[model samples]
Target: MAFRRDPKTPAMTTDLPQHVFRLRVRYDECDPMGLVHHSNYLRYFEIGRTEFLRSSGGRYREVEEAGLYVVVVHIDCRYRASARYDDEIDIVTRIAKITAAKIIHEYEIRRGDEVLVQATVTLAVIDKTGRLQRVPEALLT
Candidate 1:
């Protein structure tokens, strides 16, 4: 299926205002129908989110080891197209909002000019006890 260009923005443009990460759709990620399974899209989003934090000088493991955790409190995604095995996709992540104890990220998954999925995720920072805590100061800068 031909992918659609999101009217809101061009897909996979180099000049996007936020971090862009590339990912490949593995053969095993596809279902018997030869299309990526719906659940795998969330994994793609998680990869993007993890890379975003890594690019920002933080990794999930480090954050967790530091006695803090980021739990996804809410997430929503809109699928625009199907990605097949071996397709190279780009995931663009942007910080939509940041607060003392929560962060909101927006994502666009694309293949060249075609957007396959778009999503917004909200995560909360908490300690091991699950009480909300402020995001680390270093990460906010």
Candidate 2:
């Protein structure tokens, strides 16, 4: 489901496409102490971004077939709380910024209203030859 907007959060203004993706934490996602492994948060953010792209009619296969790919340029995840196995989590994703050749996505991993992780990922639109290219116009709308 998609969130209408969060009036209180400056980040949730009406301009960008905000997508919410939900998932259940699997047993393998946790560590010996039972908290989700730090690296898995990156994976969750990826899932959130991919789903967001899908809703915008941006199919990865179609993009690749057109000889374009979204390749990660930067990622930063900040841990705030712990996530445990079997927990139902939500990954809130939004387009933080879009330029001629790149897109930036912001993500929040939460268990209910409690945020477990916050992340920002930057990706470049690259061609099959690995050279930067302009982001597709369809993705911005």
Write the residue-wise lDDT of candidate 1 on 18-120 in tens digits.
Answer: 6789988899999998889988988888888888778867678877889998899998999999999999999898877666677778899899999999999
Deviation from truth (RMSD, Å), model 1: 8.9
Model 1 residue 82 lDDT score: 95
Q: State residue 32's C-alpha deviation in candidate 2, in Å.
A: 1.3
Expressed as tens digits, the lDDT of each residue in 20-121 for candidate 2 is: 999999999999998999999988988998898898777778878888888999998889999999999999998876667777889999999999899899
Where is model 2 more than 4 Å wrong at Cα?
Answer: 1-14
Q: Per-prediction TM-score, please?
A: 0.84, 0.87
Worst window of 10 by summed lDDT in candidate 2: 5-14
lDDT of each: 0.80, 0.83
Q: Could you say which candidate leads in TM-score? A: 2
